[model samples]
Target: MADEVKLLGVVGSPFVCRIQIALKLKGIEYKFVQEDLANKSDLLLKYNPVHKKVPVFVHNEKPISESLVIIEYIDEVWKNNSIFPSDPYHRALARFWAKFIDDKIVTPSFKSVFTVDEKEREKSIAESTEALQILENELKEKFFGGKEFGFVDISAVFIAFWIPLFQDIIGLKLFTAEKFPNLYKWSQEFLNHPTVKEIMPPRDPLFSFFKGIHDKLHSSSK
Candidate 1:
């Protein structure tokens, strides 16, 4: 029987984009159900009762939550176009960087950019920059997982697409060719990938939406 795959995702969500990239890379045809985060759906609540979050991957009546986990699941189920490296050591390294991106880079960077307090924002920016520098060092080649785009590359999609929008919204620049040359080039390569380019949201709407959130955060904090 063919697998019935459906993805519940929110627009402009980096986490959701990870799964989208994975599905696209694996050539998996699935229905994308957009979720209104303002008012989550009953299906989202039912599938992901704990987090009630988007990017829930439903496969043949079973539900999988968490972006990374969903991505791994997709790769495992669809054997063609493997995302993880076949070598054990390289695969471990890929997993390590993916986790580091979530913990050290994405979390701190978001806090740094979105926080209303100046001191907290500065601290987070410094931490995020340090983390990014580490990633820049790791990308010694065209892609994080060597020549081909794989797990680590998919995991870091936020750096390519979303961070630019965040930079415009917050009026601060964290990523630049001069500052992080390797990552800047990698971002360009990642964004320009045929599948990624096809699925990316328009920049104007993304900027407006995040700008509204930025304004709300600042206003509420006042």
Candidate 2:
């Protein structure tokens, strides 16, 4: 039998979208099963019992959780459309920066956007800004690690897409062209890439979806 692949994911999720981008880049055919994170399905729980999260990738009968791990697996399994650098050191650097993006930018920015506490929100914003400045200085090329859109690019899906949406929802002016010109340019390139653009959720629906969450958070805090 041929290879069987399935992605259990929620719509409008940057994490899920990144995996989709990776799959599309590799020209892999797979089924996307929409998951309602509010009431997660048995498969999600079964496949990813530890995290109990969406974006659980199943190949044949094996399951893998975490977006970065799944992407790496996809890269290893499919040689075409390589996602990481060929050189050992460069590959190590790619992993390092990807981890930095997650730990520094993605986490802090997300906390800044979603938290109701003013002090906590400000702290997160500051942390995110500091990390973003470091990224801006490092990002001198078309993509991370030079030309090709590879591992680090996929890892930064949150910064490219979701952070802007979050900024809009919360009326925060965190990431902008003036503050980080290199990142602005990079986001444009990453967002417009054919493989990435094809799988990205439309802005209007995504905005509305996130707006509802923001409104709910504020109302609860009140």
Candidate 3:
């Protein structure tokens, strides 16, 4: 019997999106339960008591928290469309970059773009830009995993999708084709992937929502 799989996630969360993309890539069918972060559901709380976060993956009734951990679980369980590399060293490298993205890139980038304080924003932008440049150098091939969208690719989906939107909302240009040609090209390809294209929400509404958040943050900071 196939283990029943279900995902609790928020609509626009990049962490949640990571799991969604991984599931899609592996062709795994699962129920998606959207969570309201402001009023988190009882199920979400029950499944993820520690974080109380979205993106709690329940497989065979066992809960797994953390986006990257869930992605690794999905890859292990559904081996048909494997995302992680088969070799030990290659897998380690993939894991290293994925961790770097979460710790060094995505976290600081979001903080920089969303924070109301100018000094913090500048600091985060410098940190995130440096991380992005490192990633740009790492991408010697078409994708992070080289010629295929794999673990590192899935881990860095936020850079491919949300960064551009955040840049527009904040009126900043952090990523450019000329400055980071490889990453810029990777973003284009990642966004255009059939599965990715299918799951992405319309740009206008997303931008409007982010703009409202941006305004709220700035107003509150005043």
- Pick the lDDT winner: 2
Clashing pairs in 1: none
Winner on lDDT between 1 and 2 is 2
Regions of candidate 2 where Cα sits further than 4 Å from its true position: none
lDDT by candidate, in order shown: 0.88, 0.91, 0.90
lDDT of 1 by residue, 47-150 (tens): 99999988899999899999999988888889999999989998888889999999988898788768988999888888888988999988998988788889
Per-residue alpha-carbon lDDT of candidate 2 for residues 157-212, written as tens digits (9 for 90 to 100) = 89989889889888888889999999999999999998989999888998998788
Superposing all C-alpha atoms, what RMSD in Å does each candidate have to the true structure?
1.0, 1.0, 1.0
lDDT of 3: 0.90
lDDT, model 2, position 196: 87
Error of 3 at 193 (Å): 1.3
Compute each candidate's TM-score over C-alphas: 0.97, 0.97, 0.97
Which has the higher lDDT value, candidate number 2 or candidate number 3?
2
